[model samples]
Target: MTQILNGARKCFVQRGFHASSISEISAAAGVSIANIYQYFPSKEALIIALIELDLQRHRSLISRFWSTDFSPKAIEELLADIFLTPEGHAVAVLRAEIASEGARNPHVAELLRDSETGLIGSVHSLIRAAQRRGQISNELDPDLITERLSLVFEGLMRLYLFSPANGQKLIEQYYRQFADTLRLRP
Candidate 1:
């Protein structure tokens, strides 16, 4: 199943969702088409699996927020891990492809919504925790903060994708601004 998912991801990244075929994925996986069908009923199912896998990884990363002392440096590291690394760039590209597919596919769109909901919940928890620690202002609503942060993250991903050369600098600027805004003032 992992092999199939990895192969599907590679193929999807290279050829996109619409152009990638089950046979191509199977060949890339070094498995038979029948084997793929045994695990995933359709290409859409495979895509959902990949999305779920990505979500699991995100959940793991978010969990780290709870274990560490909340600080601007920690947040910056998280952002860098998401936006600046080679693996991060690959995931961003794959996410863009998945998002494009979701625009036209109701099932994909629903899955994306579900994924976002889970992520938002995790972020909400992070905000609440920061508030408890006096790292962030308690006067602000966690729900609102989570929503705005989600928007900022989406914009950052777009900036990184569309303007690679300046994306890192722009992200750093945005992060600094974000850190300043959230930090509690004496």
Candidate 2:
């Protein structure tokens, strides 16, 4: 079962959910069709499992992002890394493909929604922390702020992930300037 799942994730990342088939997954796993079925009843089931695993990892990253456990420069570095690094590119590629499939697949939609909710919750927690510390205006709603910020960050990331070489300087600038406009701190 583990072998099948590992292979399925790789195949899906390479070919996407819509294009990958059970036979290909089986071959990648070095398992037979019957063996694959012993764990997942269908390919959709396997995809869902993979999404869950990815979301768990993403949640960990989100928690770290909101902790403010580092200096301001560190945060800027983090954003730059997300947009300019090789690891970031691979993650973006897989996420872009899976998210595209999610647009047409109900199972994928569920996982995506759940993942976004958790991510937004983490961002909201950070906003609340800032507000409590008198860093942000008390009237600012954390929920709304987190949502808008998440959208902005994701949009910025999408732009840079596609053009890493030319995108790094612009992306780094945005991260540096973001605190000025988005902080909302008195």
Candidate 3:
């Protein structure tokens, strides 16, 4: 199953979620069609599994982030690590592909929503911790702030996927401005 997932990830990364075919995944996995179907009924199912795996990884990353001292600088550094690297771009593209398909596929949409909820929960926890530590303003509701932060990230990812050069420049500018704005102290 792990082998199949690794193969699917490779195909999705190389050819995109929509363009990647079952045959291609099978060839990459060195698994028979019957075996693939036994594990995953359809490509959609396979993609959902991949999304779950991604969510687990994201949760792990956020958990680690939350374990440390929460501050605007820390948030900025984490965001840079997540959005400014090649691996980050690949994950962003995969997420964008899933988001596009989610618009058309209700199941995918539900899965995406679930993943987002998990993301928001993690961010909200971090924000609340930062607020408690006087690292960020307590004026705004943490949940609302977390949602807005998520919107900013989604916007950044969209720009990054569609326009790389402009996106990198914008991310640099945005991260600086965002870090300053999010900081409670001078």
Candidate 4:
């Protein structure tokens, strides 16, 4: 099952959701199409599974933040690692493919919506915790803050995708400016 998901993710990232065929995924997975179908009824099902897997990974990443001091520097570091690293670039590519599919497919759009909702909820909780710790301004509304932060992340991803060469520097500068706004004022 993991192999199938990994294969599907690779094929989708390389060839896009529509261009990738079951045969290609089967070859990538070292499994027969019959085996893949036994686990995932259709390509859409594979997409859902991949999204679910990404959600789980995101949840785990959020939990790590929960355990930390919730400092602006910590947040900046996390964001940099996610958006500026080589592994992160691959993940970002996959995310772009998923987002493109979402634009054309209602079901994929719904899944993406659900994933974003879950992410927002997690980030909202993180914001609330930071407020309690006096690391973030209590004047900020957690929900609104979470939404805007999500937008910032999406923008960062887009920027990185568009300009990989300058992504790290741009992300650092943007995040520093954004983090300054979030920090509790002396």
Local distance difference test, per candidate?
0.78, 0.71, 0.76, 0.77
lDDT per residue, candidate 2, 63-132, as tens digits? 7666653345666566555666766666666677767778989878877987787777777877678678
Return whichever of 1 and 3 wins on lDDT.
Answer: 1
What global local distance difference test value does model 3 have? 0.76
Worst 10 residues of 3 by lDDT: 177-186
Q: In candidate 1, residue 155 scores what lDDT?
A: 78
Q: For candidate 1, report its TM-score.
A: 0.85
1 Cα displacement, candidate 2 (Å): 5.0
lDDT of 4 by residue, 1-186 (tens): 999988988888788888999999999999999999999999889988887787687677767755665455675677676766776776778778878878888987988788778777777888788788877778988877666656776777777776777766766765665565576342
lDDT of 1 by residue, 1-186 (tens): 889999998898788887999999999999999999999998888988887787787678767755465455666677677667767777777878878878999988988898888788888888787778876788878787776656776777777776666646766766665665566342
Q: Candidate 3 lDDT, tens digit per residue, 46-97?
A: 9999988877877877677665554546655666665667777778778777
Candidate 2 similarity to native, TM-score: 0.76
The lowest-lDDT stretch of 10 consecutive residues in candidate 4 is 177-186
| lDDT for 112 (candidate 3) | 78
TM-score of every model versus the real structure: 0.85, 0.76, 0.80, 0.85
lDDT of 1 at 179: 61
In model 4, the Cα lDDT at residue 50 comes to: 86
